[model samples]
Target: MSSTTQTPEATVAVVGGRLVTPDSVIEGGVRIDGQEIAEVGDIDADAETVIDADGQLVLPGLVDLHGDDIEQHLQPRSGARMDASMALASADRANVAAGITTKFHAISFELDEETDRSPELAATMTDAIVDATDLLVDHRLHARCEVTQKRCVDAVLDVLDNGDADLVSVMSHIPGKGQFRDMAAFRSYYENSSNHTAEEAQEMIEERMSIPMETIRDRINRILDRAHERGVVTASHDDENPREVERLAESGVDITEYPITLETAQRASEVGMTTAMGAPNLVRGESQWGNLATIDGIEEGVVDTLVADYHPPSLLAAVFVETGESLPERVKRVSAAPADAAGFTERGRIQPDKRADLIVVDPEPTPTVTEAVVAGQPVYRADATTGESQ
Candidate 1:
């Protein structure tokens, strides 16, 4: 799903469930008119469609703040990429089944020819997502603009100017440093995924690492200037220290994604920037990259929102794992808080006049996603025994 540009207009009645919204919970039914939630009450009202949400929990559809899985689908392997449309459809299906109603497909547009290089491929993939918006659930582009790739930046700007891009993030994946700055780790990552031999991966890493940090900073500033001019929401990636957090705050970046330390997250919070951590980090009880755990940020009261990041199912599962907080309190970590941070006023809550993005989960020993409604249209439903979209 590339865009959330369309919504349905029919009325739907979802009854016999506990409604979980931004501000309140009701043991009743929710009414949806096309895409916007028309009402929430206990009256067993009937509409064109009626869902039997008996003994279930109804809440807002999961809103993923950031993710790179879409790109993974587009290019599953280095050389064995799938058709763009088919990849998108499959990814969207996977996300919907995992309870995400709104998804931000993080597509990296970095033009290069080394282990990670492609201009035509990036354009083709992004265009495919933009063009296929109507056929999927609420979808939007979260362009991970790599500053090192100048040509890729140009392509991304063209797409942004054409109103094809929704959310834009300034990313710098320098060869030997930052997110994968360690030469050994970088080589391992390349060798594990691509057609590169271990020797070739080392050589590529050495070649890229030789570039000065000043050059990297300059490229980032250029991208930031262009991004700010377009009125796009800008975010800093993988910030690991207080200095990095301060630098990003000074640049007027309002969102901090994946801060690597608790101090960094605290600094971001003090400056009023929203801190986003991966939900998987909480579920796994540790950061996969050995960075500061998101649970730490939450404990310190510094983390504001949760993103699905790489795995869609982690969002719902993480809520259950959260200790000490009530289900309603834990929900703010993913639902209302992220919506406010992303500046989406119409979503993230169950309220009058809000978009009707909701899911019905049967709260068994293990919760089950029973029905999912997007913009008042029933998009997914599980059978009594078969987990299928009805």
Candidate 2:
């Protein structure tokens, strides 16, 4: 949660844009001196660069706490692979175009024999992400450790100890609970993703379930301890029940990600833990796999942040879909809330002396990003006709 180096002694003013603040949207301008916001509201100061935003809404750049879209860019096909550094550079541009100035790439340490998400590959990707100094946006790693993968615990510890991970989330994907509560859905997912037959999937599930709960707990605690030692944030994923939520909260989990039911989400909220739901779930109106609807969770006042999850662009669109709340309130779910949850307090809002990570969106007919400025530097500008970043 460190601020980027300030933009060299250059002043840029975004004029005539509707500034979306925490409580209201004011029709004014923002002045950026160096990398921090120098002034906001009715700025009339002469600046070296003036970007006209007459017909756009200037909001804080989106902060995505968890996004796995980079995995698609890295390994588009089952056997096909792209250079990790090249894929990370592409991911940076794509995220900035989607108005995401701060993002945490969710890399998995689930070294299953049936898939390519191995520990070695995860390490390589982590190094690539860390070495991507040319990226236009701030990038971090969310090391998703599959607790059931006992052999991968050392690998997860290595990443945490090496300072490659900013956040660590422990996930237990045992069948008959959590995301795969429905056995039928579990079978379908396993078969479709791994090309396994029903019998093979069932056998795999049985084998995974055979691992002792004590073993799983020990592995998870080890990961959490290492994360704590490194001062990295920790979260629990796919919490299924109130008991599980309470256990994770008691274990000092900072956030609860994708709680499967309203009761579970409520439990997390009651325990004062931040709750995160997927933006795609809100936009799709339901969970792709059978689970609590994100919109419903939002209505119930349980969800605190909205993560892009699999679709980076869905973050902005999800803000518009939340018509019940004001634009400022809805935008926080994708920006300030997530940033604060991830311990990034400097760049989530438009305030004086804060990092100038902002985006301008045109909300006529359909909401689209017109320009994205990160740390006072304009990184992505959309073509007026095609709406693609130039």
Candidate 3:
């Protein structure tokens, strides 16, 4: 939980760590000059600070394209609420401690009859995330716009127009499709999460199904257009089939966030779309909702990026899961691939001239983040007694 601000003359050299580059792992370490990586080979010159990472893995800081764990911080329990800014600050501490230096806070614009996720609350949350500039890690907004909720479209558009949205993802949580494709699962989720009865959930599902397909399509296109005009990255959530993938590709979505099936993910990859899966899925070895297993998708070479999703710490552990790829390649799935999917060309790799966003990890007894540096600033360090950061 200790941090250090980087001065203009501040320089750091991490020596003896296993440096994970985009292509290879170097036993030698790296040198950080100012806010950029100065060298990736042997460092023979003197430096202001030197961290001996002798038996650790030194890799680029994780870039999470989508993480919604902040919601738990905002409302730790039912009927309990905390200030959005305070919650965001707490989330930032957790994210940085988890070795995630760059995080896109996924804020939902979906209005629920039984929840406080109204349009007004969404705007307030977006502003809170935007105003939280004092945080140590880089925080961006990923506006999850629900196309089924026509009333929320204008609010999402406002976020895009005002430049509060760094990335916009279109999602439709209507029961019978997307994440809740199985009616049994949908009923269970609605009854458990919203305290809705079976009859009420069915009625709600029918009402959502009554919405015209053209209306949903038009609203999604409008939001995507606005996001594209503003040069923001856009994504489509829970693609169900190849036709949905084609539609998203045609709508100019750069990334596919969570395909429900392996075929759909493969189709997205075949169509040249960046396919993203949740890190928790890989770590758990299965999808939570009986969807396509992310490990299988990785083995099939269809999944491109691994996001933290609802668990911020899963990104680091997912890199060590036994995928058929090399260590460098697996690390790229959580780091470089996510950064590239989010249109961040400067980070996600430890190379010369790139931003000095790095993490020192102890990979032996357990994969844990020992230290995390973002843009040459030391943001988090693990406690020696508890072996935990923050």
Candidate 4:
């Protein structure tokens, strides 16, 4: 008879801190073994590493259900580029420092080769993500597939079909119609904020906005069919109207990312699609694009997850800023809600058998992350430097 030897589980007991489990906050300790949480009681046990939380609030590590923070890493400017591996490394470290254990790095696949949005670059980035994550926090690819990019959809979908894509978003950006109907308003975004000349802005928009809306929507349906078949989550980006929300729901989209208006947000909620708002919007005190305030959406009970958008630390910062009635309840907006939205059952909660991804916060109005543990390993320590620099 052949027998196999079982591996011994490594355990660490975290005691004396305020433990924030999924169900409730306990003023006690937790025990973790290897990559899973072991206990949550007062059992005296030795640990390889002991974190003295010292009355700090212990919560699950933040889950960024949506964002494009990594895009800056790959492409620092419209024309400038960097090494894929280096960019991923930098972005990954920034994300971990922000207490993000799970990240969905939004990469836009623009159809036109001249647009600088390349499938080749995305594939390279995805490969780097798989390789670099061996010793780092969990990072995944979220391709913001502009439905208008008819030529690139096939290539982008190929990545998804091959398991290269983690989250696929279907978005349509047409000028003088849909989200860009207000040409004057849209002009301000490209002209004033981006500092693009009228001709340059028009050309770029013309290149992206050239595709027909009907064709793009039809293509979205096709991609959704494939995504559903693969069990990959689908999200509708920048929903502007009720009809769009209804259509996305019919297409089996569960996440509605950045609904531009309040009506669209409400419609998405009515349809039971989890709404995602930008964390930077919350941190900056308002939306840069002049959309519905995330705070308002949260108040209306329409917002479900907080995405980092452009800055990873904003995810943790937003939680502190929104603790109006209760801190634990507000923290859940960043932790549990986004984790549930992303369909990650193990990492979001501080429960036994769950992945030991947790953080210790100072419990102040502008709380700082004291420690960050991912899969039972310390990835960040505030005393080691709190914010991103370099």
RMSD of each: 2.4, 1.7, 2.2, 4.3
Assess the local accuracy of residue 157 in candidate 4 as a C-alpha lDDT between 0 and 100.
Answer: 82
lDDT of 4 by residue, 300-355 (tens): 87888889888888888887774363766767778888777777776788788888
Better of 1 and 2 by lDDT: 2
Candidate 4: give its CA RMSD in angstroms.
Answer: 4.3
Question: Which tens-of-lDDT digit does each residue in 196-242 have in candidate 1?
Answer: 78887777666566667787677667666766787767787887778
| Candidate 3 Cα outliers beyond 4 Å, as residue runs | 1-5, 385-390
Candidate with more favorable, higher TM-score: 2 or 4: 2
Give the Å shift of residue 50 in candidate 2: 1.4
Q: If the candidates were sorted by their TM-score against the true structure, best first, what order would they fall in?
A: 2, 3, 1, 4
Clashing pairs in 4: none
TM-score of each: 0.91, 0.96, 0.95, 0.90
lDDT of every model, 2 decimals: 0.76, 0.87, 0.87, 0.76
| TM-score, cand. 3 vs. native | 0.95
Instruction: Give one digit per residue, the lDDT tens place, for model 2 in 1-390.
Output: 222455599888998989999889999999999888999998976998888887689999999999999988987888788999888888887888788999999998887656677888888888887777757899999999988887678888999878989889999888887898877777789898854777889887998799999999989889988888999899999999999989888888999999999999999999989999999999889999879999999888899999999999889889889548888889888889988988888889999998899999987677788887789887778976786667
Q: What does candidate 3's lDDT look like per residue over 134-203, in tens digits? A: 5788888899998888878898999999988889999988778989888778778987885577787787
